[model samples]
Target: MHLSLVTSVLLTFAVFWNQIEYQQLIGSWQLTHFEGMEKIVNSSQYQNASAAEKAGMDARINYRLENTVYQFEEGDLLKFTDLENQTVVQKEAKIEIKEGNMLLIHEERGDRLAKIVEFSDDKMVLQPISKNSVSGKLIFERIKK
Candidate 1:
């Protein structure tokens, strides 16, 4: 009887711990991607562009995932801010958690930006819905407080 009670307690603790770990990811994250010099040089646009133009374009593409504070008035929005351009774009929609993935819908500029998020440990991969181009995946690591 004592062995069974101990086992039950351990199981309960394990479940509770998992819930806490999942909740820790409910915060903001900064996103970045570094392309190799070879890839950049081989691209037609980059090949024709001057050094300063290439650098400026690369800077503008970096962004941040700002999920720290959500607003109900903005239709349950999640914001992604462009660090280089200092632009804050709000994604107006609802976020739903299903199974182990997060689903979000944002309708703006006549285009819907749907995303699926999968997280483990301190890392998350966000894949956005795309039509012609291949799906773009943004990998993010949780920022420490």
Candidate 2:
């Protein structure tokens, strides 16, 4: 009986601690850098692409890295806002944490899973694990209120 009680207490503490850790992610985060674009641009596929195709990819990456803000709100709400236009591009996203450290973002467009590579009070790095078009570490810094 004593061992069972100890186990239950430990489990409760673990769940509580996990909640506190996840709460750290609830805020606005600005994309500071993207590590995968360089690999994409330097790939042979990109090397042989037409000028227009290469330019388009470059434009898209620039838009994502420079103009995107990811907001993780309470109640599992997620938003992707464009900094340039000051508009929310995706307002219907829902967030979930699975496998302890994997962040699952569900959206109408698609569901994406990213491994939480590193997380702290003011910074986070996510390594994309889903089959998204983009592959690389997304580095973000918390936006101060």
Q: Which stretches of candidate 2 lie over 4 Å from their true place?
A: 1-20, 40-60, 82-88, 131-134
22-141 per-residue lDDT for model 2 (tens digits): 577889999988887778888998999999999988877787777778888888888886543644355658888875578888877688788887788998888888554757798999
Candidate 1 structure quality by residue, lDDT tens digits, 20-96? 23244466665543233345557898878988988875655433334222322233444554333475644454444
lDDT of 1: 0.52
Which residue segments of model 1 deviate by more than 4 Å?
Answer: 1-24, 34-42, 63-77, 82-86, 90-92, 99-102, 106-118
On lDDT, the candidate that comes out on top is 2
Count of clashes in candidate 2: 0
